[model samples]
Target: MTKNCIYSIPESFLALLTVFISSCLFAQQNNSDPKIQNQFWKNVQFGGGIGLGFGSGFTDISLAPSAIYNFNEYLALGAGVQYKYLKQRDFYASHLYGGSAIGLFNPIPEIQLSAELEQLRVNVNLEGSNTNSQDYWNTGLFIGAGYRSGSATIGGRYNVLTDKNNIYGSAFMPFIRVYF
Candidate 1:
């Protein structure tokens, strides 16, 4: 009678294990249903910046277009292209064109933080009697934070790497970002 009791206990345990395994498989199948999956293109956002300035002997015009892929509500990665034209009277004229990659995070709905790596190819031509031209590359790493609105962010970013040859005159710059 003790042997029969031991054999019956194993059978009971096996039945319970089978039921548990079946339930788990059913849940997994429901989660993997194609109707519930997220599409890739739905996660993309596009935005950029534009600037124009004119002075006595200086004129600056710039255009930058960018796109980002948001993995969720909090994190995004993006890239952009930039083109800028500048002319300073009796000093120099230059054309800058390049691209940048950026990563962004939002801890709360009202604040956004970012890190960006930018590279620009610069071509400078001396004005006045000398018509010498020089070409080089300028790179910058920027870290920044900003206040967020509906689809726009207003913030300031500081270049972690800036020197005499850096494109932007200041290490700190205020920015406005808009995306849709």
Candidate 2:
């Protein structure tokens, strides 16, 4: 509330900022990674295009793009985002949110596993009048098993969990997944 107080506050604020800036500059100048510059791309991958899945409230295919990481020949992991068509006996093609998680084979063999979760909200107009709409959220889970070779992966997953908005059923979504 006074001129002296305002002046005192800025002095300490600037001093703290100066120390933080100097510390970051010092840290950057002293770091070293032998392969950081040349081998950076080996740790990343990409997957894309049409995909398929089947489960509760979902029995059709979809399109997806994914990214992956390779830790070693026996261990790998990945994540992906997808735009999916949820197949309900009563509904047509709709928008859904989906993601993928993968676990690679161990012991140097041709086998792998994965888990995926997909969710979406659908709105319906009562009396089909297009005035006010009713919204419902549907989610499904897929736990898969399969094989991997370098950049491609194929697997099948069962429904580990499903939150239904209407009539509920139980099934496994046997799906083929590709990792990049």
Candidate 3:
């Protein structure tokens, strides 16, 4: 003969569960309310950068997409991802992918200052005499300032971590940033 088994619920657990459900039901701005959610999303801004260049045996194309949460009129925090493809005739073809975190400060309406940290994975294929493949990681920390007008900013940033063998080949990079 077999006996039936019974599991019992603790009184404390039952009371906590009742409170949780009640609080959820009485919440004024829960995620289930689309209006409140939309208000929260209104604080976010989306933006990115794109590059395309082709000339005498050289081709370069890049795209970066980013988003930011504006805490107020003067401060914002954001993140972005980038991909770049480059080819130099008979020399090498390379692909780079990276991501970055950025912080922005606007002391005045027309001036914006920024700091960004980036990390990238580089894959290169040498096409000529020493045909081979190379893979490595590169990182950069950039500090920049820009002139802002409406949704666009024209600026330049310097990478403090620049080294002779760095992928960008230069410490200073010019940029045009736009957001919508």
Candidate 4:
């Protein structure tokens, strides 16, 4: 009976090893099928930010819409549009509009690195007597890193150009992103 027990133990372990190996091989084969490859536009994601605020005599509104196309598990390219309006009491009002192109790289599943180039046009109007207005364009380059969990991402970026008049308003910008 001892001899029989020793043989059965090895037989059971060998069977389990065989099952594991075959399952792994099947998964590898399935992953390599062309039909299993991601289709273009199939994994596109769309989401961005909206900002709204109201104070004693101030108002701020912003809308930014973005879209991303996943080329594979590790790379994506995207674009976005931004618009903002701000008014303070009876002082001045400003409008900012822009567009951007972005690229993302993921070396690991949960970590992302991104780069973007944007061109923005700013219009400022004085609320007082003369009703004067001025417009200008600002270009920015930003690089960033983020951590992604499921469909949400939180990140920070630094503008390399860092123009004082850039609509983004700061050298460092924090962003929250959701993918749908």
Candidate 5:
């Protein structure tokens, strides 16, 4: 059973990699048309968030990268990938990786509303005489509102499905995003 669980990680990673590569290729193909290429590049944005923490016995790190395309002034859609690692001194470690789809609405120039749906695979390893490990999947939905400036956004979100085993840690999460 453990071996089967371990195998799933590579499978999942491969699947995500395929999607990522396909999207990039598709975008490149579409760019062959000058008008479409200009419009596409103009509407596309890149941004994400990072988290870091360290203490005497523990460390946590998170990175999320995303791309967004503005369909119009009021609507935008995007995809993102996330990676996180956490460790506690001589005790245990965990790795999380996932992807998400995001939607955003801007009713005004400075306020934005957003929603995200994500699927994450988490693996935990226990360091001890027994040396046990486990893997599982977690799905989450988040809704949030934020203040948006020219190229920066700050927001807080609430996970409606607050599973105790979630790698995100809490029902509420804060984020800072900068687009280029």
Candidate 6:
């Protein structure tokens, strides 16, 4: 019985080690395969969105240019600039910095959701005593979704100044995103 006990102890330890090693191998296999890894540099991406704005007695559209640095299989950081033009009312522009992350929820990927915020300079063509000049600052929120493969996104946003100058509205934009 003593000999049997010693022999079983080694066998049990060997079994545990085998399980540990195999589990690690399984984990590696479960991650995206070589093809996915190669495509990862498609990781870094750049894109832009355009939107139309209404209200405040203006007909306006906005152009947003953006850049992203993807850091991993599921996370990225980005910054964007928006230029808004009113046919004859006001001009508004802003620069935004933010981060993003994506999750593959299904094998047939089709959609993604993202959120963002922007530190903003709310500028407009204010009729000055002499000339029109911008005179406001604010922060705002942006939220939206993307349909994979289409390089298109639709989003809505709003902005308000800490001092009560409000530029609140929504926009619709189609985007073209290219990954490198």
Query: Which is the leading candidate under lDDT?
Result: 1
Question: Each candidate: what lDDT?
Answer: 0.93, 0.63, 0.91, 0.88, 0.90, 0.55
Clash count list over all predictions: 0, 4, 0, 0, 0, 0
Q: Against the hidden true structure, what lDDT does model 5 obtain?
A: 0.90
| TM-scores vs. true structure, each candidate | 0.76, 0.59, 0.83, 0.74, 0.77, 0.46
Candidate 3, 65-114: lDDT as tens digits: 99998889999999999999999998899999989999999999899999
- Show the colliding residue pairs in model 2: 45-180, 46-180, 143-157, 144-156
What are the per-residue Cα lDDT tens digits for candidate 1 across 1-180? Answer: 999999999999999999999999999988895644656667888999999999998999999999999999899999999999999988999999999999999999899999999999999999764547889999999999999998899999999999886778799999999999
Candidate with the larger TM-score of 4 and 6: 4
Model 6: per-residue lDDT, tens digit, 1-180? 899999999999999999999999999888858787777557667776677877766566767777766665345567777666554433433332233332222123455455566655655544433355555555655444566564443332222222335454434333344443
TM-score of 4: 0.74
RMSD of each: 10.1, 7.0, 4.1, 17.1, 16.5, 11.4
- Tens-digit lDDT track of model 5 for 1-180: 999999999999999999999999999887686886588889999998888999999999999999999999889999999999999989989898999999999999899899999889999998883547888998999999999998888998989988767666688998777878
- Where in model 3 is the C-alpha error above 4 Å? 1-34, 129-132
Which of candidates 2 and 4 is the stronger one according to TM-score?
4
Ranking by TM-score: 3, 5, 1, 4, 2, 6
Model 5 spans with C-alpha error above 4 angstroms: 1-33, 129-132
Report the poorest 10 consecutive residues by lDDT, candidate 3.
1-10
For model 2, how big is the CA root-mean-square deviation?
A: 7.0
| lDDT, residue 76, model 4 | 88
* Candidate achieving the largest TM-score: 3
